[model samples]
Target chain A: MQGFALYPFDPPGDIAALRAELRAWLAVNQPQGDIVARANCWASFDADFSRALGAAGYVGMTLPTRYGGGDRHPLERYVVIEELLAAGAPVGAHWIADRQTGPLILRYGSEEQRQRYLPGIAKGELFACIGLSEPGAGSDLAAVRTTARETAEGWRINGQKIWTTGAHFSHIMLALVRTEDGSERNAGLSQLLIDLDTPGITIRPIIDMAGHHDFNEVFFDDVLVPHGALVGTRGQGWQQVTAELGLERSGPERYLSSHALLAALIDAAGADPDPAVAALIGELTAELWTLRQLSMSTAAKLAAGEDPMVEASVVKELGNAFEQDMPRRVQAIVTSGWDDADDLARLLRALLIASPSFSLRGGTREVIRGIIARGLGLR
Target chain B: MSAAREMLCDTARAVFAEAATVGMAPIDNAGFGLLLVPEEQGGFGGDWGDVNAVLQISGVLVPGLPVAALIANASLQPAAAVSLMAGAMGHSLALSIEHVNTRQQFGRPLGKFQAVQQSLAVMACEVRAVEAAAAVLAARLDAVGLDPLAADFEIAAAKLRANRAVGVVTSVAHQVHGAIGFTREYDLSRVTIPLMRWRGEHGNDAYWAQILGRQVAGFGGRGLWEALTAR
Candidate 1:
């Protein structure tokens, strides 16, 4: 339990160089669209854009060179993703695979799995989605009824996973399933890497309120996976999934979701704005700035191989609140009722619809608060 | 934590704990006022990280010290800023926790209620956020030795966060403690009153927020992100 330090956010010379290189590449190759449309940030999926990003060697940055990755520090990867999200780049296609799955595979995947999947992921040709949440088990992941029983033909899986983002397009799914029956809820659970196109698998899009097709419901009926599909040890799924959630919760993406809108709001507010507006914007900016520092500090701990699970949960919960509050604040400040065609108005409207999901995704507010309470020894 | 830093914090904690029980002044004996000054200048040659750790400990102990404010505006001669922000915030939280755990309203302790737990969780989050901001600013100061242009923005942000957190923490704490907390006789009032006063010290939330807002505006939309991630 190492105490906290103000983690340096100043990019090192090499990371600064990487940031410059990525910015230059984005300047030349980024797709043309209204900035508001791109405000969706990581949720904006573009396979071609992801391919371009991978071809440019920006994807799978933290992996080893043997796997066709940059083999850089996690801080380097952090710099890259921060830049991508700030610029409102469409990174959704390869986001999950690069951010969590690739690293996880490197840690726990077999040599065969590493050779087969990591290189593709580094190349951005392969994409993945999480399959931890089921229809009845969202925040309470231990209640997942997805069963993957072993057989002569490897393992047979039968269950459904809801709110599986990018399931329609992902090439792989890391499914948390029950492999054994036990009195303990977390016991006997295991994570299996299931290829999305396998037989007896079905995926249906669950369009969000913002009319985004980023989420899907995936079903499996006797879907057979190879015996080698299991990740880490069986019955260790609880630990592995918890670790994965740490990655999910503590990233630039956690707070940068509405960054584009904020930038636009600042632009819309103009210079020498109303006192109330200036203060509101300032408060939000201060909170956002502080949240980034907190997130970066957690990242530093992760880079140092510390769990910092409690800190990660705190960042996610607070960041979720800030992100959710952003649109309403903007709506209050910019009350002129601009035309729907205006970029700022459109982005604010988009965020208003999307804001509710900020707290709901990754973990609900209640669940995160419970985690925080437990961390503080209050429970 | 390094050996020296750990020693400094432990000494501060021990002194503050003693000061909390006795009516003695913690700063008079703790030597925290001299912690930031270099040894070559006839004071303890400690860095910002050490001072920050001590301040957080002071917060927990509610030692009613102005060590942070003294360090914040340290001159050739140490001047009192009379700010007890950290100590007050920490003390209020501690009092609330103690109150909820020992004081029962229904069939169980107050802390056993879900509402009280949620409020305390939020208060803890605010405190942790301020701690993080302070640590970040301290690290930046340690690295660059207080370049005004860079350090001012970070300092403003940290102050703003701290001021804001004190508001939430003090309010929730008093709410948890109920009417007893409002009385001067109660220990909670000792911290809560000081916190309200400290919220205006150095700079209040609104004052620092305006400064931060101006800086963010000066950076423009695209450049604002660069300015924030610059360090």
Candidate 2:
């Protein structure tokens, strides 16, 4: 096993050029409006914005050019997303498909599947959501009760997936279900690329406490799917999903979720803010830089085709903690009371409300700790 | 790892293991002092990453020895060896984990307890943070030779994080070990004491945090983010 040595964050010249290009494009195309509107970050949905991003060749950056992508490295994609998140661009509509689904399809999808989905995904015309978490199976996905039975024509699916982000707006779902019954929790599971338009599939929005309709409870009631929809081999859903998480947990989104809020806080704290407040900002900034380095290292590993599951988990665990802690720390620093009308106060309010989901989304705090413990051979 | 670095790490590990049992005096003969000196400068022209790797391994193998400090004094500045100190702190953490895994209480290993697990988990995270900070600093030092002013914030941040980590790690490691860790008979003090001492050597968390605070304040609110992501 290779030890966790220090990897340089020096991007190639082309990657730097790509960053410049992306910044130029974002300057011209990104929505210009209230700072609070950008607070949603990855959760903010705008189809036209996503299409414009795709048109600029920023969406499917890492996929092969043969499939309408930029044929760039994952590090290039990292640079693009870093800029996007830093600018608080609304990328929610194409975020999942661009980030994970496109690459996943290219890797595991058959020629037919890839030809059918990858181009649309690359074009940013298709959106995707994961179907791993069921009603009782969030972190413990092996307990998934969703079943997909093989039929002569295809496969029939039945089960409910809870907290499925963007499922209502998605074109497809890479559903994980039990294709065979067995004693082993992970043995019989399989991944199915289910079309959201398939018969008997219903996606009902679950309004969050903040009144955001991003989360949905997707019901699969005898939904029919073709045999080709099965991704990879049968009984390999666990492995596939675990592999997918390396991509999921290793992105800038993990730590940059509340970056807009941090930027807002800094902007609000003018040049001559309180010394104590400045110190707090410095500490947070240092931590953010540290986390970004860790994250970029994981991206480097991914580019080298390494799983880095444990390292990715580390990034998510720490990144989530930092993001969730941002609002409270900001609240503590900005001692001068600002009314709700103040943008800084409004951003802080939004973050405080949404910050609780930071850890809960990618993986819960307990689950992440458990993963870290297992990685350390403690369990 | 380069062939030279691999050989150096293996040799250091073996020497540190022997030194751990015999005494700290053998560390001078371990060839760590000559690690960072350029070949042209009558020393091994080793990479900073390779040197830091040895430092971390040395930390784990023989935490009591001031071998890393000696290497730091020989290669970089007295205050610049925080990365090596971080490696030493990691060794202390590794020692604690080993102790907790083997130390049984009430017919079970102490690691089986949730409280112990949580403490160790937190320790592991701190260890990771220190490692990350140190790695970033090492990379920066390697890319551009250690100009103290250019790398001031990074060096300070690494030291501060490592210093803070040592406090948490030692507290938890000692907590997990109970009274034995505090005694001289047990080897845990070898690492814990040095961690406590080394944290105060370059700059303690409070000291560096104040510097970093002033630096950030100087950058103002908007300039702070730019300062952080400058690299």
Best by lDDT: 1
The candidates' DockQ values read: 0.55, 0.44
Write the residue-wise lDDT of candidate 1 on A52-87 in tens digits: 999999999888999889888888888889899989
- Cα deviation at A74, candidate 2, in Å, is 0.9
Candidate 1: segments with Cα more than 4 A from true spot: A1-13, A181-184, B13-33, B57-84, B102-106, B147-150
Residue A358 miss distance in model 1 (angstroms): 0.3
Residue-level lDDT of model 2, residues B1-231, one tens digit each, is 678778888888888889988877677775667877888988877767776777777766776667766776533542345656666666666777788788898998887777777677767777787788878887777777755667777777777667767778888888988998889898777777777777787666656666776676667544655565556
Single-chain TM-score of chain A, each candidate: 0.96, 0.96
Candidate 2: clashing pairs of residues: none
Off by over 4 Å in 2: A1-3, A10-13, A181-184, A336-339, B10-36, B57-81, B217-230
Can you give the TM-score per candidate against the true fold?
0.92, 0.92
Q: Pick the candidate with the highest DockQ.
A: 1
Interface RMSD of 1: 1.9
CAPRI verdict (incorrect, acceptable, medium, high) for model 2: acceptable
By summed lDDT, which 10 consecutive residues of candidate 2 chain B come out lowest? B72-81
Please give the distance, in angstroms, between residue A34's alpha carbon in candidate 1 and its true position after superposition: 2.3
